[model samples]
Target: MTNEQVIRSFFETVRSGKDPDQAPHYMANEVLAHQINGENRVTVHRTPQNYADHVREMIDAFGTFQLTVEEVISQDPKVYVRWQQRGTHIGEYEGYAPTGKEIIELASAVYRLEECKIVEYWIQIDRLGILEQLKRNQM
Candidate 1:
């Protein structure tokens, strides 16, 4: 499959909550993830196992989640995706107890592919907006 198709399938897998098991098939063994939000930034050297663990955590925190892909663009080894995610907070997340609130958030991701496997990625999400909604529901 093309890089664009690979990314699209990856998102679909994530939307189906099957990311933990399928990540290895789409991502390279030595994947790099850069996540930036305003003044905070984190980088992770991700392997299939570690990526699966992350996906499991997300699934636990956000129950019944759905990711809507707004746009997808690819040029050779690079792919970009604009997406919106909606889910219900059914479990603890980032130390916040379950608020049972539905959240809608936007995010963008850029992926670099090598030999049809995603090798590197950068992701930015509406963290502040999600926190606000969770806080509001708690009050």
Candidate 2:
């Protein structure tokens, strides 16, 4: 699979509302890296394990989240995508209860592919804005 194909498949899976499995097969293992925070605009370099944990956390929190690709730019080993993600806060997340609120957020991811697999991924999203929309912030 080419890098473009890998990135496409990843987005397709998420959009299909399937459980966030098949991640290991979608990403490279050796130097598989990721960055996932509000300020994560670039890959901070990490292992596949980090992304794995992230996926699990998201799944556990949202139960059923959807990531819609607004636009995608693909190259041999690099794919950049802009997306919108929305889900209901139906489970515990970061010590917050399921507010039963649906929140939508803008996000992006940059993937570095190696040998037809994603070796690195960097993600950014407006998390604070999301929290505010959910009305879970006491401050």
Candidate 3:
């Protein structure tokens, strides 16, 4: 798939509040995404099912989070994405009750694709923004 197509599908899957299964057309069955930005951490999932819990966690916390792609520059198998994430805290998040706060964060993700399927992604987003909205000063 072209870089544009792959990125488009990512947003669609999350926005639809659906599982990766909904977009098998975009993955290699063993898709891997790395949390390199928001979490400032790196983890890899070998299979789509491997990320089921994380997916639920994300959709649950943000409660309608959307990754809006702003700029994308690709050079085969690798693409850098500049995006904004917007969502509302509507449920239990970080062991806290629904704060009913909406958060917007700027972020970037470097996607690694194999055979047109995104095998891995390195993402970064502003966690402090959400924390501030929750009225908890971040360290």
Candidate 4:
């Protein structure tokens, strides 16, 4: 599969929390996942199983969600994807209890693929947007 196809499948299957076990099909055995929020950044080493587990946790919290791929661009081994996710807040997140409110999240990621498997990715999420939505309901 091409790098763009790999990313699209990963989002539709693994990231969508539909079939996270499919992570291994698209990700390397050991992958680097970088999370960036403004100037703060953290990198986590993720195995296929670890990545699957993380998706499962999100599914537990968000219930079923719709991930819409807005744009995709590829250059050699790197692919950039911009996406939007919509779901109901059915489970707790970041110390905020589930308010059953509908939530929409926007994020962008750049993934590096080697031999059709994703080896690394850097992702930035609109966390403040999520927090504000949660906070508004709390007041």
Residues 27-139 of candidate 3 have per-residue lDDT tens digits of 56776667765435667765655455566776787776776778888887788888887778777776667766776778787878777777777777676766676665222
Name the 10 consecutive residues with the lowest summed lDDT in model 4: 55-64
Q: What TM-score fits each model?
A: 0.94, 0.77, 0.76, 0.96
| Whole-model Cα lDDT of every candidate shown, in order | 0.86, 0.69, 0.68, 0.91
Clashing pairs in 3: 37-123, 37-124, 38-125
Query: Where in model 2 is the C-alpha error above 4 Å?
Result: 14-19, 31-50, 136-139
CA RMSD per model (angstroms): 1.3, 3.2, 3.4, 0.9
Query: Looking at model 2, which ten-residue stretch has the lowest summed lDDT?
Result: 38-47
lDDT of 4 by residue, 1-139 (tens): 7899989999988998889999999999999999997868999999999999998888777888888999999997999999999988899998989988888999999999999999999999999998998898666
Off by over 4 Å in 4: none
Model 2 lDDT per residue over 55-74, tens place: 66776777677778898898
TM-score of 3: 0.76
TM-score of structure candidate 1: 0.94
Backbone clash pairs in model 3 (N, Cα, C under 3 Å; residues 3+ apart or in different chains), count: 3
Worst 10 residues of 1 by lDDT: 14-23
Question: Among these predicted structures, which one has the highest TM-score?
Answer: 4
Q: Which pairs clash inside model 4?
A: none
Of models 1 and 2, which has the larger TM-score?
Answer: 1
